[model samples]
Target chain A: MERVLFKPLSQVAICGGTHGNELCGVYMLKELPRDRSGTFSLTTVLANPRAVDTCQRFTEKDLNRCFTDTLLSDLLTEDSPYEVRRAQELNALLGPKGSEATMDLVCDLHSTTSNMAICIITHLNDRVGQHLFKYMREKIRSAPVRLILLTSPLSEGYSLDCLGKHSCTIEVGPQPHGVLRADVYNQMREAVDRMLEWIESFNSGTVFEGGEVEGYSMVEKKDYPRDPETQELTAVIHPQLQDNDFCLLKPGDPVFMTFSGETIHYEGDELYPFFVNEGAYYEKNTAFVLGQKQSLLVPSISVEKEQ
Target chain B: MERVLFKPLSQVAICGGTHGNELCGVYMLKELPRDRSGTFSLTTVLANPRAVDTCQRFTEKDLNRCFTDTLLSDLLTEDSPYEVRRAQELNALLGPKGSEATMDLVCDLHSTTSNMAICIITHLNDRVGQHLFKYMREKIRSAPVRLILLTSPLSEGYSLDCLGKHSCTIEVGPQPHGVLRADVYNQMREAVDRMLEWIESFNSGTVFEGGEVEGYSMVEKKDYPRDPETQELTAVIHPQLQDNDFCLLKPGDPVFMTFSGETIHYEGDELYPFFVNEGAYYEKNTAFVLGQKQSLLVPSISVEKEQ
Candidate 1:
């Protein structure tokens, strides 16, 4: 039997295969060569090992969504052998109540169902998340990325969200079952390198001024269809927005109009489209800039001799 | 001469020998042991090294206060060949835009004029700060410690404050010139170890639950008193208060009336103290337990034909 032991080292967590089908993140982890570099004092772990083996979303529950304090504690205490054991193992490595080698960052890797490029999901208003996201965006500026979504608030019981305030989820685009794309792998590797570099810079007393993106925006409302039989909510997306398309609308502009046999009436600006294709929702990239209104600008004036 | 190359590594940072009389932190760093089990990824830098040799606060300006982005950036881009070159070296190790290996943590060690236990100054509502503070409290529970104060609302332009979020300022009590305290060194070493443990925990997917200590109150309210002749603000501390003392007043309580020579009168259900001790301003421990109100309990008759 393999001996279960705890080594006194800095830990690095990488979570992949949360969707059961996506493989890019997993492949990247498996392929990345571990070298002894003075970059990061790293201790890495692969969460949801069983899910990765079975190629299933989850066995009985979504492992990513089962990271609540109560659930994790209960799992740790229970006699049953489950994935919670992995979490307990991680905790042991973190040490007793007073041990100093605690977590600094948690990067959970994943892949979306849609064919979008790499994106990072994290909390809004988080300093580390914002800085890292800006750094990552600049690292991969020329990619077929749809949007870097901030989905922590929407999904409360997420693994990375529960780890630390600085934790983030990296989502690579759709990958064929059991196959990882080279582009996605390269991006993930680059991100990991960037993270290590950031840590090194911090320890060295050097300032790392991450790149400045445009800004951030929030997703106020999303349109969905209703089921005909049960009248329950169902998946639906209309007026699919293209990348970087800025939506311009004045106050009180009609946003949603009900269709009645060709009659298209106006509806109030309850859900105005400010910037279409604002990208995925994440904490740091939550806000995005909109086109400046011409009316709001003050007209330039010529100065007199007094000026 | 050495190559003077900028090597980006995770190493410790030591600063503040302004007064030739105060050098506890500097000595501690110089005497730190190199042999350890876990990885010590750090970049070591001696801020104001010249001051250390000269036994002075500064030659031109207070280096601690010169942490603005513009000033630092200028130092990085200037034409001078002295400290500017050092700044350039530090930046190269920190990495340029999109460079991997950024800084992970920074600790600006210093010694105060007054005698007190070690204290960590960091921003409130910051997860990293909370985690580090909690870990330290747990480790030093058996020590001869008075209390751990968390200084918040940090004024701008301090090195650690300007650090990439996960940074802290460790202040040690007054020590004789060029003297090293074993206790202080051990405490700092333990703190650094705990920091690494935190990073490991985070990397291994262990969630860091902050202590119930919600926040801290400022000890001093009035601005630093200026010297009569120099008219420059001088550091001053109020009288220390005992733990669980009666000097603190609840929120909205009159500050003048409580501090005046007159006796305090209370008309409400209960009056809670606010600022109590010399350095005590507010409650740093915010966690509390839920208790049942006395009015909620009732005696019930038995259901056996209850006559």
Candidate 2:
């Protein structure tokens, strides 16, 4: 197999607190106590200080959805949302978006209320990302780490990680908003440690042989059933389905339970559910997302020497 | 046993959304759909509309703490907090605290992030409350229902339930903020049903017998380890202690895990911990409250007729 070569990573950025109330990432970046003098120059940032100060998800709009190119170049005025202005400032610090000056890698830390374990969410079919993800899955044993490939292209990505030349998002959870769990935080730290280890080995001319790795590609999202008048959810994720992320959801499986004590079942083809009962998504109207499993034939990769 | 007598509950209020984000209570009150035409007149309330509208805990101050007489009587001015203003309105409708016009019973519904199943929180040693709690415990079978005797007297209580002549707080849990779980909501609904059933039986000249019931009484609260300079939490509830509410904590038992992976142990005498890893209490500077277990020797009670 031909090795996919790339120049050694020169600059890498890590950010947290994109949604502020996701405390695992917020604290990880704020209290990182290590001498990070490594082969790669590292930059750490708190993505949303205003929201983190009050432990709110965001002030005006979700900063995560503000990173798209269209929003990045939008005219800035006093009436602009707080996240829009902050996103521009962040773009200046770590990114210019699709430019040579962008950081070599950007790894954003996120947390969710769902019971999905550590998830590596990245753009699909990127050899560099797949190899790194394979390394992380093999190395981290503290939690069951899984992969999720975004269906959209990198150019259309809206997350903060999309700012880098090569990017990956490390989302760890089951921790509630505004509450930090020691195990969740430690799992994220361990994953980051493993990522850094892989980066150093790649930069030092070590060849990583990759064959096959399994990942989930997002198919569609399902919102909770709601009352037409109130727009409030009329049903809740069923107890049988709650916290059962990454499990195959089949047709006729119980999915929701209405307030009147009636069970609602899934009517679609077999697909795996993720992000079941995420608290933040309650307002977003999303109950869970269904994903289709796929096998990625990752290729061997090594660092390319500077010409 | 001598039958303790009281005038049958006349005006009853069941309130929810006091702490806005506790959805178990919020939805139960909003979606209560049954023939509630009974012996006792019932008034349902959605407390703190401003906060509930945005799915936040509160807008200006915790409404639960604003019911204190001092705050309720504080001169309503332009500078008063939103909750203080709301508290005054609530007092006028349901209470003139320490007066004859207050509702007969104000049973407020609440939910917690801790796994403290269905908890009946009430003022300690009130015969009427004890008998009703005993009745509910015997009737409800879906969830483990327990009792919590508030250490503070009703005169000094700050909760919304204090507005009633006789009040009880039904707190159910393990549900995250802004997220509703069907099981938790159903547990609360069952409790309210049992309470109404008790009320009807008591008003119909039925005698209730109670011997002893197990309950927990309040003790000191412990805060998470913090960095003195930054005031940011330095540790989180240990994996061993997370979700283990109502479990005993003894000297040398692991209580917290530092961000740097060190375990901190409890140093106090054996006590049960409740509200373990509660998300809202994180900002209140409380990790969990230690409780002392007690056995209440309750007396028989019956309705006191117009005499």
Candidate 3:
């Protein structure tokens, strides 16, 4: 095999089972061949090792929520919770405060119980990220790819993806915690390989060329209807909307079904609902998030120019 | 609709999540219509309410293991672990120990990460249990049904199934904890409904006519190949055996493949493997269990004859 030599690039893959029950990402990172020859330097990490070992969501706090700026500095204590200290260690490894990131790009792998497609979560302002998303949408035909830009203010510095200059978190689902499906595993493995190949192509001066991406922009998270007194869930995902995630939810469409067999129609304007009935979000009472579809413009990206 | 009527029978279904992460049984029981008219009186109880709420396998000790005779004695105290106390409560509710079982039948629902199909686990001597298993095996065609006899000496009086005179726990899988698959859930629902219908027929003087049930009798558990020093898994299920669960593993068949691409052949006789790579059994270092095929004799079971 002829080696393709190109400009040096440093990329890292940060995978979390930090919620611990998510086994797809953990196993993917663990099973990845440690050493692979490529133009770009690649490093793989298990973001929450302890949680992965225990196969729980987290030991004390949700590790995904511990990456805020305040929690990063001066709050470090010897007796701090596992996730807080792990976040600080991750910061130093992937991103040191007030310093250039050691990694040029980060790929965080995640799995969910929602019927959402393979999602590429990146900031709206990231040009390179958008181009990569378009590439993956075309390159990985086994699974559909969607781009979701986090619009919440609190999401700014709270996730592992924010630790790098350019990052794309891959979310695949309709799977539960601690279970690995061969089909799902194969899809995820192919994704990691495709991602690495894309990075290699980028460093080797090959543009992703032309492609179109259809994605949803973050709008709002809608919680399930609950009773005021006991706060018990009063309704479930309506039969029409159940497993029909990412479909248009126009006004008058059945969105919820009350325990008493009454259907609640969507009262809002047309939008697409994703993350329908996600198991992890049950504690937060979230039924799903509604988003509006928009065509994403993919800008040409060059690795050497960025470097 | 003509309703079948006959001798009255009290049958209680004890669904365990008592460890809580197993949601199939919990949801099946919860979603089952509260009032169904039948000859057999039905009562359903969530074995481990607290564990079910937390979606964990268990809060303290394994709830299934805490049902031993010693733990059921007067030694249980307020300071005892959560499951120990929970076991005592269940005893009063289901068994009221050292007396006749409070219920005629129990159906403990369980899920596993293994590729095992719908399994009916019961003691070897239960004539009525075998009849029900044979009926389910023939009726529930969506998934194959297997009968597993808990031949272990310690298996007696240590599980919720022991709380009833005629009980067979339904084990369905290849699902993760806290997640529910529509297919798996539907299968379980149908099984529960079928079991109830079978019980009704038995009580109404209808004999489950004829069916030969090909079942695998428990032989032994086989663990994965692990590193002698660090005890890390050194190989994965071989390609030949992956998803080939419940098939006979003849001598010299491929069973595992080492990380270095070496094949480790199976040296055992023609025994069948089930529960391959079950997530819960990882703690026990169990890869799967080997069983020998045997024709289970279905005895004509009538409620009046048993009484």
Candidate 4:
């Protein structure tokens, strides 16, 4: 692994409360060092104000899911939901998309009820995102910055970060929606601060030495047990697996428990569960998303543009 | 305290999901033996189906709060939101109000994000409610069914339980809204089953021996610390007081912790806090409510009509 300088970015946007009930990002973004930049412009946004007011995931539709190209193109529809219009407006503000984006870097903030530590979700090939992840892994002390790559099959064009090529999301949690836990709050704040420092260093053409990073690649999501007839939940996450997010779930592990005291075991291959039992994902039938570990030597980003 | 026989009721409704995301009630109600009729008629209703579909507290206004006379009376207004109309419809179905009600008992079920135990909230003078509370106290094994009396000044007429004088609430918690923990779910189901058995005994002219019950009375609610400039939350529940729900708080006990790490101490007389740091209460500025403990000897209800 070689240390190489990365090119300085001209402008970046830091966003929070995209899900509304997630308060850490909103709280942290408000206190960020907006004045610390002589090298680049920093724009902070509270993405969904109406949802935040009601302490909900979204107002009409999920703001995160409303950023699809089709939805953004149909922004003029009079019957469009609140989040559709918001996506179009945000796209215009930070992005025109692809190369025309005003934001050279986009850092969207989110929190989960999962015990994921300083999670950084981005495209697998995103160089800038990888650089940021490496910086946080080396810099942040409280917890490891776990990088999870969203593979090609997972639709990326429907999220705020998709508006820009050099974008990443900061996801930290185990904090319930609309509730602020001091431990998680501080962890999230530190994540944002470290991320900002990483951006600042990149903008200043500081070299980020390449290092080995341990992370997971998202596979697929699994739904909890539901009644075959009514489709309502028939079982709950087992007591053993309840708060064991990000832990390796091997075959035969107890996964769910029926009301009558029947325990259901995991019959699948070993996988790590993240975002276990997130309240926001209840409607989606998501008990948790499985991830597979990958050990990689992150390459340094060179400041020079290849001719 | 000597147990006396309570009058048999003709009909009862066990309701759940009033807040939609509270799953224990909805899940428990689904499996209840609705056909059993050796005693009173048992009707199970999932209160806010739309909110449950979306895994939120409500669509427009809180369904629980929408039961007020003004909203129920104004159900014909096109301006009335989903929950308002739902409230009016619910009142019409389970209630007509007071002594004219067809349903002898309306047990509204709820779950909180707070660490509240199996809580029974109702007017202290409601003798039947007190008897049920005493029954739960003696029967349920996990936690004591703590009673909280909503005095007249508290505006009880605004809630679903206010539909009839015989109505009472079964609130259990430490569970987040959308996520169902198996531990909490089982506890809630037990509470509901025990309640039904208590009702059946009353209906069968079975004498309930009077017994002493331990519970609390609501004193007042306290809001969390907010920034003077933005009115946004500036503090969180102190680590020491976070999960200490139903536990006594002395004058010098820390209740809140500022973002800057400052601890705010309780300054009032010794009172227990319930529903501490409930995520749903954030919008209402409710950090938690204060409760003073009370020990009461519940009297047996005689089935005989004295006239």
| TM-scores, all models, native as reference | 0.36, 0.98, 0.83, 0.89
Prediction RMSDs, each to the true structure: 32.3, 1.4, 5.3, 3.4
Could you give candidate 1's per-residue lDDT for residues B107-190 as a string of tens digits?
667653234455665655344555566666666642322223334343243443334334566655433222233344445556
lDDT of 4 by residue, A1-307 (tens): 6655444676888889899989888787777776773667888988998888877789889999877767878837778888989988898898866655457778888988776768898777677788788887778888767888876522346788777657789998878788887878878778777777777666666666676777788788999888789787878889888878778999999998987779999988899988888877867879988999987777777565434
Q: Please report how far candidate 4 places residue A245 from its true position, in Å.
A: 1.4
Q: Which ten residues in a row have the lowest lDDT in candidate 2 chain A?
A: A29-38
Lowest-scoring 10 consecutive residues by lDDT in candidate 4 chain A? A149-158
Docking class of 4: medium
The digit string of per-residue lDDT tens for model 3 on A16-123 reads: 565677777877766776788877666778888888778787888888888788887747677899899998998888876335654667778888877676888877
Cα lDDT, model 4, residue A296: 73
**Residue A200 error for model 1, in Å?**
2.8
Q: Which has the greatest TM-score?
A: 2
DockQ scores for all the models shown?
A: 0.00, 0.76, 0.24, 0.58
Could you arrange the candidates by TM-score from highest to lowest? 2, 4, 3, 1
TM-score of the second chain for every model: 0.57, 0.97, 0.90, 0.93
Could you arrange the candidates by DockQ from highest to lowest?
Answer: 2, 4, 3, 1
Tell me how many clashing residue pairs each candidate has: 61, 0, 5, 6
Q: Which scores greater on TM-score, model 1 or model 4? A: 4
What TM-score number comes out for model 4?
0.89
Looking at model 4, residue B299 earns an lDDT score of 80
Off by over 4 Å in 4: A66-75, A100-102, A138-145, A153-157, A202-206, A227-230, A300-307, B1-5, B66-88, B100-102, B153-156, B202-206, B227-230, B300-307
In model 2, how well does chain A match by TM-score? 0.98
Q: How far off is residue B227 in model 4, in Å?
A: 4.4
Flag regions of model 2 displaced more than 4 Å. B33-35
